[model samples]
Target: MTPPTGTPRPAQAAEAPARGSRLRKATALGLAAGLAATGIALSTEMTAGAAAQGSLPAGTQLYKDPNSQVVRWVAAHPGDSRQPIIARRIASQPQAVWFSNYSPSTVTNDVKAVTTAAAAGGQVPVLAVYEIPNRDCGGASAGGAPDLASYDAWVRNFAAGLGSGQSIVILEPDSIALTTCLSAQQQSDRFASLSRAGAAIHAAAPHAKVYMDGGHSAWNSAPEQASRLRTAGILTSADGLFTNVSNFNTTANEVNFAKNVLAALGNPGNLHAVVDTSRNGNGPAGGGAWCDPSGRAIGAYPTTNTGDPAIDAFLWVKPPGEADGCAGPAGTFLPDVAYALASAGASDPTTPPPTTAPPTTTPPTTAPPTTAPPTTAPPTTAPPTTAPPTGAACSVSYKIASAWSGGFTTDVTVRNTGSAAVNGWSLKWAFPGDQQITSAWNAKTTQSGANVTATDLGYNAAVPVGGSTGFGFQGTGSNTASPTAFTLNGTVCTVS
Candidate 1:
């Protein structure tokens, strides 16, 4: 991700607008206010059965695709060590399907299949419409329908597949956030195209909740993003805004950021927000490195029960384990990376609710405290007995992820195996060969001779029992023997 310019704070925008624009804004404001105050049911024309199944009602189950990349990988490698955890944590969750390819002819059927299945299962499906021209600003995820006209046609065809079911459409990630790459005319053309795209989707499937990109918490200021969104016609064309798509920013920050953007957009109570919580469990890496940074983990599961009324749901807009072009080719799924993210997130179940609303799902069971020995005899006869403190224990897996002639990259996974949670951690190990550390991500590393130490950053400091976290580094040396031992907080750990 580009370096953050500011936090999600409100800024000013002029009230000036043309007459037509003023009328449209006023109408939207009344519609939103009426929906909130009266709890009025959405009309059949306004929403397909989507209000019940597609709008992600509280405690609603999101559709889990049986043929997702992670599911196929899990089925193929049933015996892999990471299979169980990945299958349970990553594959089982509902995530968005991207219609990123610019095939107008087949896009309809491809989308229909997913929506059809979700409709049959009485679940909501999240779809990401990303075929905008010059997508990603000519970065790794570049290329789209060539121009605005073709993009409008493609989006119309894509909308045909909503299948009268409940669906959430995340329209063109990075479309607004990365618009800096376009010239003034290009930007206007793109915005017009986006506005048309939203109109087309709603025209075809009024039930589909179309959310425009509000960028992430760290990128554009709230007012600037709101201004861009306004120009793109978010207030009329889309249901709300989505933040942190495929980016690792904290849900808390994204929530605050999204609220700020909504306020700047006029704060119609009906225009809600959803956060991409797929890979933000540990928040952003230090320095805001966006490309496949290590130690990152999965955020909250896909749930519509976001305690906050302003926030609608925590959606997994970006599938987990997809490389951001650093660890591998962009969009490539790496099982090892997926395992680390799941393992790191699996242990901690106490994710604070986004607001004061009580948790929807029951919390994980906690270990009961040990009972002290019965004091049958007088204290003078025997000293009062007490339970021993639980010591930290963990297992370390060291893998050489990639290698070359003079240098190689490695990923080390540390899993908590103790009965108690690890509040903070420090991993120390000695290299078997003359490998000198060059640089690292996820952890702060310092090497002396063959010995190396990696400590947790601010976000990744805690390790609940059975939870895992990982860090990676690049080094120079011919010798690449895996370290045989590791220590977490001074306690020796089993090697994998």
Candidate 2:
């Protein structure tokens, strides 16, 4: 299904054609949830016993694939300018190795090679099994097993490689969530295969943890997703669900969305969630441009250290710098994007290096725009308006995602710190130096004088108490200083 925002879902591209193909040619295969309200907590009562069944055991050392695309690229270009940061930040991190090709003859051995190495090191390896029939709904990352029966057999071979040690499986991303092109019978058959796929894996590798897709928060509603998971046999088949696979939603929103989904599923004791923290540090590009829109950074490092019990781990399911099929062929690792993500995401507090995988998530290092004169400068900064005493207050974060000569782009996040949910919002801010907004997204935004006003679009109107919504814009002129003040629905907000 199309996301609520009608944005394109990020593509988890198919893996490389073979395991060692990248070492010779330096290529690899690669691959959102959201929260609704602010401070929404999962019902501990519902997930009380999940701790015992959720996540790989604490202190589990996640396996870092030595042959990942970044690793090979780093080795191949040791003296390149971007090599140092890419090696230190991304190549060293532990990311899932996708077995996306339908190579039945060698599939078992390929899976075994990875799991066995992890077992030798007493670490748990992550495997993304993406060969579902009609995967990606025939989109850019399309082509999987030709039929469901073939998929089931391939899955069994995949399970054979899991050894006796603990392993994690991100089973068939976009399989359950992106079924719009399938007929009812096609969906049923696919779901049945998924159910059997889980069973076959567990039967072969009892120590493996298999997670199905939960879609992201910006996509399906909790109840709707829960119903889909149920029909897919999530309750009895899989260990948990995964979110933000290749998307760029914030970690906070994914956590909130996962909890709500679990709550709707009646909080099964064995069901938890893992989120993809590969490229979401700066959140979405806004306006649903998921096809490798520029200016994204990496998110939280992969780890099981998430303090919340309902969340199993924050994983690097999508390899950083791998094109989302837009910037390059889906799985090719581009150094420019890799370097961009590393340099930019390095300073982010939410994105730390992983204990086992060095560190992958980094804050964007792109400088905010430098101050410059506008073509049509305004006379003066607008005076602040009186805030209505509706118990609605907010905090705003204004960030310059990228900048260039005479133009720049920004993302503005508005968080509700009020007692009540904001049904709708209008945010107003005055430019310190007449920075003119040429275009805007995710809201009806316009500028008059040095003042800019942005109101919510219908789908994203509500900002639940403690929840946030964001919008972005492309603008002309540059300004180092953020707007001195911001008013949300006429109530002044805490600016940062």
Candidate number of the best TM-score: 1
Compute the lDDT of residue 389 as modeled in candidate 1: 30
Best by lDDT: 2
Off by over 4 Å in 1: 1-56, 346-496
Clashes of each: 1, 17
Q: Please give, for residues 1-496, the per-residue lDDT of candidate 2 as tens digits.
A: 1110101111223323111011011111111122111112223321231222555676667898887778878889865656777777787788888777668887888888888899888778988887777776665566778888888888888888787789999887777767667776676677767877877777677778989878787777778677777766677678899988888889999999999999999999889999988878888764565655555788888888889889989998878877554334566666766766776574533345434443343322222111111101122233233454478778999988666677666788888998877766789888987588754544556688888888764445567788887766667775645787998877889986
The candidate 1 region of ten consecutive residues with least summed lDDT is 16-25
Residue 239 of candidate 1: its Cα lDDT?
Answer: 81
Collision pairs in model 1: 54-166
Candidate 1 has a TM-score of 0.64
Candidate 2 has what TM-score?
A: 0.63
Query: What is candidate 1's local distance difference test score?
Result: 0.67
Go through the candidates in order and give each one's C-alpha lDDT. 0.67, 0.68
